[model samples]
Target chain A: MPKNILSVENLNGGYEVFVGRRRVFVHAVDDVTFSLHNNEVLGVAGESGCGKSTLAKMIYGAIIPPLLVKGGSISITTKGGEVLNINKLSIDEVRRKIWWIEISYIPQNSMNVLNPLKRIKDQFIDVFRYHGIKMDKTETVEHLRDTLTTLGLPPEVINAYPHQLSGGMRQRVVIALSLVFNPRIILADEPTTAVDVVTQRTILSLLKEWRENNKSSLVLISHDMSVHAYMDDRIAIMYAGNVVELGSSLDIFKEPLHPYTRALIESLIRKGDKSIRKGLAGQPPDLINPPPGCRFHPRCPYVMNICRSEEPVTTFLDNDRYVRCWLYTSSR
Target chain B: MENENMLKIESVTKLYGYGILGLKKFKALDSVSMNVNLERPKIAVLAGETGSGKTTLLRIIMGIVKPEIGRVLYRGYDIHKLKGSTARWYRKEVQPIFQDPYEAFNPLRRVDSYFYDTVTNICGIKDKDEIMYRIDESLRFVGLSLDRVSGKYPHEFSGGELQRISIARALLTTPRILLADEPVSMLDATLRVGILNILKDLKEKLNMIIIYVTHDLSTAYYVGDDISVMYRGTLVEHGPISKVYQEPRHPYTSALLNSVLEPDPSLRDKYPAVKPSSLELKEFLIAGCRYANRCPYAKEICWTTLPPYIDVDGVNVRCWKHLDYKL
Candidate 1:
């Protein structure tokens, strides 16, 4: 078997917030087990509040107060062949040793990620400074310029403030900042959702090119199925914080096993197809008090009686595909 | 000429500027003209990349922004110059459904209050029973009901549900024309289709014309009967959806179509790859064709003079390449 760079075994994460006076726990990421192989793009797709972002945050080991790591651990095999369980490490240790060195996260919105007041140069230097990595001023400038140029951004972007650039350009600067250390795995959460189609294509293509050149693994998270279709080698379909379906992009699109996955693909409005597609009936489950048994059973079209009582375990299928649905697996 | 139940835009132009004395001006919309008054209601998609001024054109059509030149005529009354009753009539006749459904309403207030506000004011209904009936009728058209949304705030519903509510509110007036601006762009794929289907049902059942403005061609193609491809504040191509999708006459239209990543695995890599062009704002300032700088087939004349609209097989294409070309 190929050495998987990042292996997440039964990862569970969620948030704790008070609704009124009572503290309610929001189950966001629940028992999500998937591995990221080297040089592959793994896409996680779900609707808003499905906890795909929370899952990415957990994987990046960015868990904070209120956002508790309820259970499970994330294992990573660094370039130096050191195996580390990220949950065991302290936040400071993870920050200095892992962040931007082993893994980097590109958030959904660059406007929120970037510092509006500082120049792009200062932002890049700040990251290295926080990590206690000293570099010559000219050398750092030259390296930053090289990365910007390679990503099809002008070198002058380093001197410009975040407000000076457009949304797309600012996103690229964030990406450039992320790539400064050449992390082995990059977790991008809805990177292209904020930009226009042309700019989105440019960012995706550039990221793909960069990944190919560096042989890095990418966990591309987006709600847009079209983006996943073009970028992902494999996909994990999340519904109500559970990995309902996992398979190759081709198999996922062509032969989706889970009913939710089927609905997702069916609901897509493709070019040259004029059929009256529709949204799934009912709202996405409330995570604070998700439905018993299968989280999707409330909205599931082919939901059986068993699906309403007992949750189905992951059923491994041919071609490394797996699905958590009563239709695919027998209930215990 | 009395063109009743018709919507016509005649050479509309809008400009925006920021410089010394506001001298450095750029055309937000440049003489863009389109019309839809089909005997049977149909959706006409205004599609383009961002900064293409498709939204600007929609705003003009909605009468939210007045164009510097040209006129928007709805049933022969100039949209911007309607009198008191005529303005209210125009408002009832033409309604706009905005993007960001959450922003469509006041988040702190009950979602149905906006419904009552519209039905009472613009729709001119005051009786609580009559208001509920009108709101319920519109809501049911979008697969929702008044009771479900009556006591609910904006945050209580999902993005899809709120969007449907907004669409229902637009339907409250029973408007002849619906100007939907990126109705489904904010929703997830599963929810987006439902909204599109609702729009489709409206045109067929309610006999209402919808001008669907979207950057996404896939959704546009799904709901659109007529398609007008815009590029940098100008309408480059306008024709039937089938004709335009199959044979895009304008270079920008072709590029826009090619750029759309169709959600089919089999048809992957079937179309030519579209290179992402930088300098997005510069296109609006181009004196000639707005798409000339990025057009692969851009000729010398494409750089100097704006290409006039040339008719080709029932499709109006703005490109010099189609000039004097036979079918």
Candidate 2:
């Protein structure tokens, strides 16, 4: 079996939104458990507000105000064979040790993450300096130029401002910044959602090349299934803060076990297939007041009496696949 | 000459940033022309990436922006020259569905007010019962009803539902042409197909022409009857959807088609190589082919002069390579 790099168990997190004078707790991610293996790509896909991004933030140890992790623990095994619980670490410790060196995060919008006032080269220098790397200006510039050229970016972009480059080019520069530290794992949230098709293709290819070359793990979060189909080795389908199905990408696409997964795949508009595809009926449950029992039962087509009263336990299937549905349970 | 087509755009050119004193101008739409026949309603897709002038073309058609070189004709009447009542009639015939549903309406006000306003002002319905009837009927066409969103604000509806409401409001005018600018790009994947289906149904049932502007090729292939591929600020290829998707002649068109990531794992390794443009702004100012900088099949002549439109297999291709090929 492949060695697990990160293990999350019974993770529960939510946002506290204020409704007039009262405070309402929205359980965005609930009881989610998954393990990320070394040197593999794991894709997390679902509709918006399904808690995929919240789960990513929790895993990356980004627990800000109004967004709190209520339960469960996340443990990461470093290359030095030391196990560290992320939630137990202090904010200073996470910033100093865990962030940008052990694990990195790429946000949905590249412009938001990059400092508009700084040049591209200065940004790289700041990251290196923050990590206490002792390098002269010449050495840093040489290193950055080499890295940018290797990633197929022009060397002259180092001198340009953020607004000077196009949206796609700026996104590529953000990707380059994330990989400069050579972190063990990368958590990217919708990296290619805003770019064009051609730019998306290039970015996906560059990510694949980076992963293979460095032998690093990736936790890619996207709502587009086609992106997952192209980049992921293992796929996790999330619905209402729960992992509905987990399996190999090939098996999940060919014979999806969960009804939600099947509906999502069927709704995709493919090339050369002109048959009218229908979207799922109803909207995702409100996180503040989710329905009882299974969260997906209301929207699921294969709802049963048991599905409405009790949540189905995770069932292990053949070929290392897993599903959470009453239809797959032997007791049904 | 009197044009019999429903909409005719001739030599429309729009330039931005006239240098310091109108010196350094950037060409947004270069001498573009197209015709939309209303004999039978069809969906014409303006497909391109960002900054490809697709949105500008839609804006030009809607009369929101005026072109410096050419004019848009509606039923043989120049849209820019139309007077008070004539312009009002033109606005009733051509309505737009914006890209972001969240910004399409005022959040403080009720969503149904837009529906009622459209019926009263654009459709000229006076009676309250008639306005309500028209609003409800138009909502039904897009698989939504007035009751579902009767007194709700824009925040009450999800992105998909809000977009559906926007479409319903557009239908309130009973437009002959619907100008949709990336209507489904903001929607989720599951919701996109449903919205596209509603647009297709509207074209057939209401006998209306739809001009959909988007950067996505999958939805365009699904809903578009005729596809026009745009690069930089020019239409590189325009033809039947089947022919364009099956046998793309322009290098940019072929690249766009090949770049689409199909929802299948078996084809993961089959992606084509895409070379990122180093000088994006320079390419826009190129006098020859704007795509020559990134196109792999570009030649010396392609960088010197613009290519003429060549008819090949019933498709109009603007590439120099097609000049040597026999059609």
Candidate 3:
């Protein structure tokens, strides 16, 4: 197996997302631990307000004020076998070494990254120049042409402005820009949320192609489970800032250990299954002062007394699969 | 076309000229008709991607947009024909819940003001106490109380809470039918079900016919009784939710079903990467079928002539291949 390219241990972050004098802060992410293997796609599946985006920001070192990384560390293993601690590094160090070169973050809104005035090819050159890569204009053009062609994007789009391109084309351009530096890991948060189903599929397939060709690990975060099903190798289910279930994509879908995961899986519409998909009753708990024990106990169908009193420990259910639920606490 | 139904959309066709400079016109809705039964009030999901005229259909039903040719009847009254007080009554009968809860209410105004305005103006509740009582009951029905949301701004509450409040405001009017346009698309998945379940409960408890317009088929399959697949403003298929979902006779319907990426890991290989075709305005106004370009089952006749609506096993499917084909 390839070496673990990314390692996140006990990562925690909170944000004062809303306006309040009560000093209300959403404990968006708390004590989350996961690792990304080389060429592996880790799908982070959760509802909105679950801190998946916040966690993505923390990973990419994109934390802007009001959102602070209180504790924990992110360690990334470089190609040279040198491990870099992302959290301990200064903003300058992160910018010079991490962002765009070794790691790239694809935000939910693809338009945000592209300058409306600049041509798509100019943006590509800007990314390359920022990384201090020394390739001539002709070489750069050739590289971009090959990249876009491989990704199924028409090469002629490089001359088009951000607005001239469709939403799907803009999204593809952003992904192509992220790949300009050949980063080791790509952090994509809801990249396919706003696009059409066909566009979403194209973008997903392109991402899959990128992972295979470059041997890069992908940390994809999306609320749509179906999007995760399309590209994810392993799935991590989150609720109220807690990673309740982690397992192979097949295992999580076929045999979900956590109540939240089970409900989420059951809620999705399957082709053959015409039975009414029952949505979970009640809302996700407020992250400000989430329930004392398990944050999901309020909405969990198989809630036990202990689930209310104490948080369950992560159990090693099977190979590489971890679940935090009372039902899986004991063996079968 | 009037069938004791809550809403009757008969051969509704909404056409859009490609502005002054453009040469062609776009057919956003192509003689698409549907009968929504009020007696069995349930969610009738009008599933389609963007530019499918789902929003246009909702606007036409709400009397915001007039169909070039066709009629939208609510309770035996042609919505377009009604004028002044009669149209006002029709508006009160059919209410709308927009997708964005944050934008639905005025940011400067308190969320409760909408509730009061809806109660007093639509329901005609004159007394202050009576309006308060009505608002309180509506709020309670959506699992929200007046105390928690009475004097709050849109930003003060979470997306889920604000959405619930939006539902409460819509409920205060006590409309017979609620047209929700992608109500849960903006919400988080965990919070989405809350809003979806609320709609489900409201359907049973209040017996309200819901014309839910959305692109997400999963939630549509979850709560919808009847399903109607719209493609660039054309109705491809419509029938019982189970039959349409199970058999899916229309090629567009089949493509949509196959495109849905499930969270399930085992079914990874089931989905084939397919992109939505970029449709031009002129393509929509084509002589025959709008989907003929992308449809693999398209025949020579499909390209030039419109396919007649054939009822196969009780499900209405508008496809040349399904004309002789039965499930």
Candidate 4:
């Protein structure tokens, strides 16, 4: 059996936005739980403002002010078989020890990660030196040249500044910087959102190749279902800061259990199909004060009276699929 | 023949980025031509990625950017030559719906003020009651109402709702041609179809032409009647939507079609390797095919000479493979 690399249990986190002197707390990511095994790709799929990014941040241990991890724990089993609770560690400790060596994070707008003034080679060298990895100028240059060429980039790009490259090339450089340490787990949040389709395909393929060759795990978060379909091995559908459905990628796409997932799949305009695709009527609930019962109940087509008053528990179905909906509950 | 053509673009070319010494020039749009018929209103999709010049072409059509060569003629009158009331009239006839709904409206101002201004100024409406009446009528077409958005600011509404209000504002003038540049790309998947449905309904009910520009192939296939594929400032393929999508003649069009990942996991392994070109500026100034650097079937001839447009069936394709064949 494959060993679990990272396991998150009942992770509850939120952002506190202040209105004048009054502080209002928005529960962005509530009770998000999932496990990523060794060498597996887990996709967290959701629309914007669904807290998918918050969940990734919490896992990567980014707990700055205004954003707090209220409850739950995240455990990562390192290669030495030592379990590290990310929440218990300090920000500096996480950055120095765990981050970029065990767990690396690539944010949504990764193109802006590079410093404009610095050359690409200098940035890579700075990261390594900060980690206390001593190397001379020739060694650093040789290492960067080999890595960039291996990642399908020309070595000459190391001498150029960030603005000299296109959006896609800059994104690749960010990816290359993240992979310098060969972290066991990578949390990539919307890595391909801004680039064009051709560039997106190439980046995704490069990521897949890297993961397979290195035997690492990846948690890919994106709002595009087609992207998740192409890259993910296991899929988790998030709605209003909750994981409404979790299953294998193939099964989830072929037969989605949750009403929100089904509606999202049906709404896509596919080729060779002339039938009208209908969008869901209602908007996503506000994370600050989401609906009481099930968050998706207001827009669900199969909503019941009980669904309006009580939240449905997650039920396990065949083929390792789990869904949070009244339609699949045994009590119903 | 003149009456049949609604909009005619004749060999339009746009250049960008003059270097310090005025030597470097990036050709954004090569010699491109197309004609839209006013007799039958249909959605003509201009599909391509960034740097493909789809957005530049849309801007040229809206008269926002001036082309260095050729002219855009609307009903036999050159758009660049129009002045005063005629230019204002042309602006009313062709409206644009931008990609971001949040950026479309002023944050401090009430969203309805834009609607009111569009009705009064662009539509040339006078009298207090008539302006409100026209605004309400257009809002109703987009499944919105004046009451819901009358006093609300832009921040008060969600992205989807804000986009609908933007569309409602666009409908106030009853534009003859709608240039939508990635209108639904920012919205959620569940909300994108609603906006697309509204566009389709407006095309059929109002008999208006929609020039939809997006990098997405699926939405293009769903709503487009005619499709034009652009790559690196060049028009590579043009034909009926289904014909071009199903039987792509140009290599770039085929590559673009193949790049669209369907929401099906069964075909995951069928994805072909796509090599993205790194030298964007160099490719833009290439003498031959811009896509030749990455094309799988590129030959020596593809790198030396620019291929002429050849008519295959009813579609026009720019490729060396189809040059010898005629419909």
- Order of candidates by DockQ, top first? 2, 4, 1, 3
- Predicted candidate 1 versus true structure: per-residue lDDT over A248-286, tens digit per residue: 999999988899999999888888889777678889999
**What lDDT score goes with residue B61 in model 3?**
89
Which is the better candidate, 1 or 3, if ranked by TM-score?
1
Docking class of predicted structure 4:
medium
> In model 2, what is the error at residue B87, expressed in angstroms?
1.6
Taking all chains together, each candidate's TM-score versus the true structure is 0.96, 0.97, 0.89, 0.97
- lDDT by residue (A221-301, candidate 3, tens digit) is 998887877788898999888898998888887888788988887776654454545667776777888998889988877
Please report the candidate that would top DockQ against the real structure.
Answer: 2
- The fnat of each candidate, in order, is 0.71, 0.74, 0.48, 0.69
> Worst lDDT window (10 residues) for model 3 chain A?
A269-278
Pairs that collide, model 2: B19-B24
| lDDT (Cα, 0-100) at A25 in candidate 3 | 78
Error of 1 at B268 (Å): 4.4
Please write out the lDDT profile of model 4 over residues B3-86, one tens digit for every residue.
445799999999998556766788899998999987689999999989899999989988989999999999888998899999
The pairs that clash in candidate 3 are A198-B275, A198-B276, A226-B261, A226-B262, A249-B265
lDDT of 1: 0.87
Task: Write model 2 residue lDDT over B228-267, tens digit each, in one string.
Answer: 9998888899999999999999999988998899999999
Residue-wise C-alpha lDDT for candidate 1, range B25-76, written one tens digit per residue: 8998999887777466999888887778988888888888999999999888
In candidate 3 the C-alpha lDDT for residue B225 amounts to 83
